[model samples]
Target: MVDLELGTLPKGRGPQLSYRLDRAVLGGGRDLKVPGSNTILDVAGLGDGVLATTLTADGSGELLKLNSAGAVVRRTPRIYTLVSASDQAAAAYASDAPLVDGQMTYGATLYSERGGSVQSVELPDVRSIKVMAYANGQVYYSASVKGSEKVAKLYSWRPGSSSRLVKTVPAPLAISPDGKLASSLPATGSDAGCSTVRGVTTGDRLFQSCEQTIGGFTPDGSVAIGTPANTDGNCAISVAALNVRSGAVIRQWRGCFYRVVAEDNDNLLMVALVSGGGQAPFSKSVLVRCAISTGACERATEITAAKEVDFAR
Candidate 1:
C-alpha cells in the first residue's frame, strides 16, 4: 500500500510555510514528492490516485487530484471537506461565517462533480458540514447548525435533489451502505467515550462502548474495523475487526497503536505508532498494511514521527 507521507526533511523556505507531499510504499521506499507548494491539509481516495486539499505558501488553497506516482492530473476550487467514490464522482461542502436569518445561519456551498461537469447549491441554514461518505451520486454528511453548534444532524444530498435530514446524532462518522446504520462518537473532541453505531431512522443503537472507536466498515458493510483508545498497560494501541451487527471481535492486534486510514476488501492501510514502554509516548510511526482475516502486518513506510506520516482515506 502506498501512503500519503510528509517528507521527513523540511522543504520550502520555512517549516511553517510548506511541506512536501509524497506517495511512499509501506516501508522504507523512496518518497515521490508531488510537484507544488503542497502544505497538505487532508486527502481522500479517488480511484487509483488521491484527492488532496493543500495550501500554498501565499495562503492560496488548492484541491488537486494526484495520480499514484504523485503527479497532478486535475485540480478543483478550494473546498473545506471533500469525499469521493471514484474518478467519475466526488463531492465538496464548505461553510463560512456570514450572518443570515437573524444571525442564525452561515454561508455555505454544497456541490458535486461528475465526469467533467459540476453542480452546486448554496445553503443558508448550515453552519458547518463534515462529509462522512459518498456513493453513487449522493453525499452523506453531519451538519452543525449555526446557533445550536453543540447539536449534530445527519443529512443526505444528491446533485439534483434537495438536502434531506437523515437523523440526529452526537457526532456522526460513517454510514452503512443501505443507509440504515450510522456510527458516531458520544461527543465532540472526546477525551473518552463510546464509539457508537445506531439505526439512522429508528434511533436504535446497534453498538456502543469505549472498547473502540469505529474506524470504518467493510466494502460489503458486513464488518466494522475499530481502534481502541489504548490497549497497552500504558501506551499501546490496537485494531479489531468486529461483526457489524453484533460487535463481536473476530480478529485483532495488540502492542501498537494504529490509525486506520484506508482499506479495501482484504487489508487496512494505517499509520502505526509503537511506544517504547508503559506510560511512554509513542516513539515511532510507520505506515503498514494489515490483513483483515489473519491479523498479520506488513511494513509500508520507514519509522518516523506522527507528523511525518499521513494517509488519504
Candidate 2:
C-alpha cells in the first residue's frame, strides 16, 4: 500500500490540490476561499512545474496558474459572461498561451504566460468549441456547426489553420493522443444508437457498447480505457483496457473509477472515490497507480485541495 492520508471539508467547499506522481505527495496547491462556497471545475499541470485551474469567482469565472511553490504565477481576468445559460467553457494551453478560451466567440484573445501577452484567433460560426488536448506544437479541439436546418456537424482544429471535418459526430467528441483518433458519442435518432469509438487514422470503428464510455487513450496509442456508468447512478465506474490497433477489450476492472491520469513508461495513475454512507467531499479524493499491463492497482495517496494539479515527465 502506498502512503495514504485523508481529510474532510464541507460539501462543495474545499481547496484544489496538485499531486506529483514522482514524489507521491501533495506537491503544490491553492486554497479557493469564497464566502460560503467553493467550485473548482478543472486542474492541469504544465509539465514544467506550473499548474493551471479554472474556477468561479463572485459569479464570474477565471483561469489562474501557480508555480511549484504554490505562488500565484498569473491570473486571467474574468472573461465569462455572468448571464450565460451554460457556464461550460473549455481551456487549453497554446504555444506561449497558458490558457485559451474555446467558446463560441470569434477572434477571442488567448492568454499566455503571466497574462502579459495575448493573441487573437479566428473561429468559425459554430455552436460550441472544445479544446481536447494540446501538445507537439499543436492544439486539438472539436467544433459543432449547424446543418440541414437543425442538424449538428462536428469538426476538428488543425493547428494554425481552420478547422477540418473529422466526422459528423453528434455532440461529445473525445480525441486521443497526437490527435490521431477521435471517438464520438452517437446521435439520438441515428440507427447507430450506440456509443461509438472511432479511429481518426484509418477511419476504423473501434468499439461500441451501450454500457461503456471511452474515457481516453493511452500515450502510445496502444491502449484505451472505457469507463462504465452505473444504472442506479450513484458512483458506478468500471474500466476496460482496449487494444487500440485491433480495437479489442483485453482487460477489465470495476468500481468507482475515474479516467487514467499521470502516466509513465511502466504505470498509469487513476483516481476512485471511496463509497460509503455519506457523499465524500472532493478534497478527500483518493488516487491510485497501477501497472499498465497487469492492472494491479495500489492506493498511492490522498490528494489535498488545490487550484490545479498535473504530472510531469
Candidate 3:
C-alpha cells in the first residue's frame, strides 16, 4: 500500500505544514504533529508509517521515522531531502537547495535504519539533477551539463558504493517499481508520446507508444499510469493506465489535472485539483483511488482545506 501523508497548510503556502495520517484507509481520522518540524520537504512510505524530511528553526534538516499512529520512533539528523525510501533503507542528500542543483554539490547519503548506519558520497556537478527512480535499493538519477539540458550522464548508487555513471535514459524518465523497465516521454507537450525502454540495466529498447505520457508505475510494475494530458483538443486532461508490455490501456479517466501517487499492493492513489491548480489556501486538493483489478476509482476524501500534500513509495 502506498501509505499517504497529508500536509495541511493553513496559510495556503509553504513554511507552515501540519499533517494527517492514516488517510490512505481506516480514515486515519486524526491529526499528527512532529515536534519542531516547521517545513516538510519530502516523504517516503515505510509500511504503515513514513520517513519524513523537515526543516528546523535554524535551517538544518532531519529525518523522522513515524509509526502508524504518527509518533516518531527514530530520528536521523543532517538529512536535507528524502529522495527514496524502500523496505530496508532510504536515499537522501545532505544539502539544503530543495533538491540537487548545478550550483549545489551537497552530496548524497544512504540511511539504513535497520543497520543503524549512514553512508555519504560525492556526486558530480550538474546544472540540474532529478532522481528518476529507485530500483534494487539503487537510485537512478538524471543529470545535465552545467548549463544545458542536452544530457550529461546517468548515475546510480547503492549502499556501500560510490556514485558512478550509468546509461543515460531519455529525458523525464519513469521507472517501474522493480526498476526493470523505463519509459521516457517525448518533449514537453509533444504528441509523439513515449518510448518504453526495457531492461533498464542493459539499455535495451522495447516498444514505443504513439502518445502516452507515463506519470509513474504501479507497485506491481505491470501498468504505466499516464500523467495528465490533453484529451481530444480539450483544455482538460486524461489519465490512462497502459500495459507496459503490450501498450494497451487498461483504464483511462478524463479530468482537469489528476496526479498519480504511490500506494500499497498494485492499486493507485490519485489527487486532483477541484479548484484551479495552485498552492494551498488558494486551491483544493482532492484524493481519489483506483483499483487495478477492477479499474474503478473511489470517491474523494477531505481535501477541501489541503495546503500541500506529499507522497512516496
Candidate 4:
C-alpha cells in the first residue's frame, strides 16, 4: 500500500497536483515504481495481484490492476463516479452510465477479477455508494438517500439474498470481517471526532469514542487503531490501540501517521509522515512497519507524491 503526504499548492491555484504509487518490500528492497497515470488514488494487494483506483486529470476515476510482480494486468476502459474494491476479492463500483426522464441514472457494478465477470446490483433510493467491504460471503456497504445526508444507511448483500439494511450510520464507516458489526467515523458536530461501533444485527452500541479518531479494526476484530486529536497539527503525539469491546486504550504511540493500513499480530503497517521542517510544502512521506509492542519503526519505502493508500488483507 502507498501513503499520502500533505503538500501545499500556491495560493488560489486549485488542487492541481500529480501523484505516483511506489512499491517496496516491507523490510528492505529497492523501490519499484508502478507505471500508470500519475493521479493514482489508492492501491491494494488483490489476491496475487494489486488493484488501484485512479482519478484522472479530467475528474474521472479509473480502476487498474497489477500482478504480484508489479506488471499491469487489467484496466477498465471507461471512467466511473465511485469505485470500491478489496484485496481479498473483486470490486463494486458505480457510474453515471445512462439517463431517464431527463435525469442522470446511476447503477452499481461488481467486477470480479477471479471470475472475469461484471454484474450489476440494484440500489433503490440510494444516492451514493461510499465504501464497500467484501468479507465472509457478503458485501457490506454504506449509502445515503438522494438529497438527504441524515438518511445514511449501512447495508449487506449475500448471494441469492436481497440487500438488507443493517443500520443507519454516518457517511463513512467500517465493517468487521464477518460483517456482524459496523462502525461510524467521526462526523462534524459536538461529538465530531468520536467514532461509534455497533452490532450490525442488533444495533447495540458496543463502543464509542470521546477523544480519538478510530482509524480501523484489525482482521480478527479484537482491536482498533485510533489517532488522538493533536493541537499542534502533528498527529505523531498520540496514537492509541483500543480494545474493540470497551474502547479502552490498550497501547499508544507517538508516530506521525497519515493512515493505518493494516495490523498483523504485533506489527503495524502505517504510512508515517516525516517532518518537513515546518516548511510551506510538506512533501516527505514514508511507509513504515512499527513494532506495536516496542514502538520501534523501520522505514520500508520512500513514496514520492503519494496521495492515498488502500490495503488488501
lDDT string for model 3 (1-313, tens) is 2222333312222111123332221222324444453677666555555667777776667778777677888877756545554442454444323344434433344333323455655543543455555567777765664455454456676757776666535564677767777776544455455555455777665656656666677666677776543345322265667777777777776564435654644456666556646553576666666566676555445565556544443
- Compared with the true structure, all predictions reach lDDT values of 0.60, 0.46, 0.55, 0.55
**Candidate with better lDDT, 1 vs 4:** 1
Q: Which candidate achieves the best lDDT against the true structure?
A: 1
Q: What would the per-residue lDDT of candidate 1 be over residues 155-226, giving only the tens digit for each residue? A: 888888788877555578777644566788766665446778777778787777577778677666677878
TM-score of each: 0.72, 0.66, 0.69, 0.72
Q: Model 1: residues >4 Å from true position, as ranges?
A: 1-33, 45-50, 56-61, 65-78, 86-88, 91-105, 168-170, 177-180, 186-192, 201-203, 230-236, 274-284, 300-307
How large is the C-alpha RMSD of every model relative to the true structure?
8.2, 8.7, 7.7, 8.1
lDDT of 3: 0.55
lDDT of 4: 0.55
lDDT of 4 by residue, 1-313 (tens): 1222223211121111111233421221112345654565555444545556666676556766666676777777433432233335565544333345656544544333334455556665665565456666666767665666464577666645577766445544677655666677644577765688876677677788867766566666777677764426744445677788999877676656656644455656665566552223655665555555665555545444443432332
Per residue, candidate 2 scores C-alpha lDDT tens digits across 1-313 of 1222223311221112344422222433422221213344444554323433334555444654554454566666543211000111222432111233643333332222222333335543443344565534344555444453244344444334555665534544466655666666666555343456676656677666655566567766677666663335544355666676565776665555434542543455555555432243443345656555765666555453332233321
Candidate 4 is scored at a TM of 0.72
What are the runs in model 2 whose C-alpha is more than 4 Å off?
Answer: 1-38, 47-51, 78-118, 146-154, 168-172, 188-193, 229-234, 281-285, 302-313
